[model samples]
Target: MLMMPLEIFATVATGLGAGLALIIAIGAQNALVLRQGIRGEHVGLVVLVCMLSDIVLIAAGIFGIGAVITAAPAVVVVIRLAGAAFLIGYAVLAAKRAVHPGTLHASTQTGTMSRKAALITVLTLTWLNPHVYLDTVLLLGTLANQHGELRWWFGAGAALGSVVWFSALGFGAKLLRPVFAKPGAWRVLDGLIAAVMLFLGIKMALGV
Candidate 1:
């Protein structure tokens, strides 16, 4: 039989590959990241939360927490409800912004309150949603376990892939700052975000 070390490494690779594949798709998560990039506010903070959340969840999936979460069904329900509320509220805000996105402010200035708010929002949005656990813990976790000893390696690969994907997205958005500089960019972005949120919210509520 193969050693655990070799199996773990391979497992991590599998996890990374799976994560990167799922993450690259357009979804609420990606939309938020892009919107933040367009707004040019707390870019690093947002990106860090996004990446760290992935790492932690993927770890949970690969390691012991997957089993723990699986045993607790109500926990998932709570997350889904909370996430639904957030999404609904977010959708309203986006729609409102679509009508009136406010004045264009210089991206250079960072108010203290906005900074704190950005950090909190990103953390909550990343960690609080049931989908995060479902995707990372449930799906990825079960997938990792199937690899036997290689599961750890699959998770390691998945986490690293997350780092790579988020870095690319964060930097890529930065590169497009000029394109986002247009006056109506925020309104359009917010509108799109709202639509995405609503769609995601409905999906969650209906258990799709």
Candidate 2:
């Protein structure tokens, strides 16, 4: 009995590590979450959306839905096109901000989006993107299925990773508010985000 628990724990740990490895990378979702965290605007709601979305996707992936989705090339193509457009548009905005970062303290107030708008933005960033589907659904699903009977536990562990990661990312960004209070810092951050988003957008557009 003790060995069973230990085995499950090990499986969970593996899932957690894999999940974090995929999620911790630079992406539009992470960038938006960090921005909300720094602004302290509806951070909870954003985190909730992100965490819940990952959980749902991971669950779907583990249940074999990912395989079905992967089999449908048209669906991926449609999502890829739509997501690429959105990413490029957002990249342009980020680039604008990078060029004119404005006062960091005032940046939050310059044109603070409504909670509803932010929610929509985050949802798009998370769901409309094909890369997210490929990562969480296809890759993670394949990995979980390798566990056989223990796949659900692995999915649960991945969900836990999402929870832990978003929590840390959303809340932890506040710790950097002091540093971001400087206009130069905001400029640098937004510039980096712009570059990352642009690269991702173009890559997705090219289907590379």
The candidate maximizing TM-score is 2
Per-residue lDDT of 41 in model 2: 87
- The residue-by-residue lDDT of candidate 1 on 1-208, one tens digit each, is 6576665666667777898887887777777777677666777888888988898888777777867877998888888878877777878877876776553332434222287877777776777678778788878888878877667777778778888887777667877778667647656777788998898887777667
Q: Model 2, residue 126: displacement in angstroms?
A: 0.6
Superposed model 2: Cα runs more than 4 Å off: 1-3, 103-108
Which candidate achieves the best lDDT against the true structure?
A: 2
User: Relative to the unseen true structure, what is the Cα RMSD of model 1?
Assistant: 2.8
Residue pairs with backbone overlap in model 2 = none
Per-model C-alpha RMSD: 2.8, 1.9
Candidate 2, 33: how far from true, in Å? 0.9
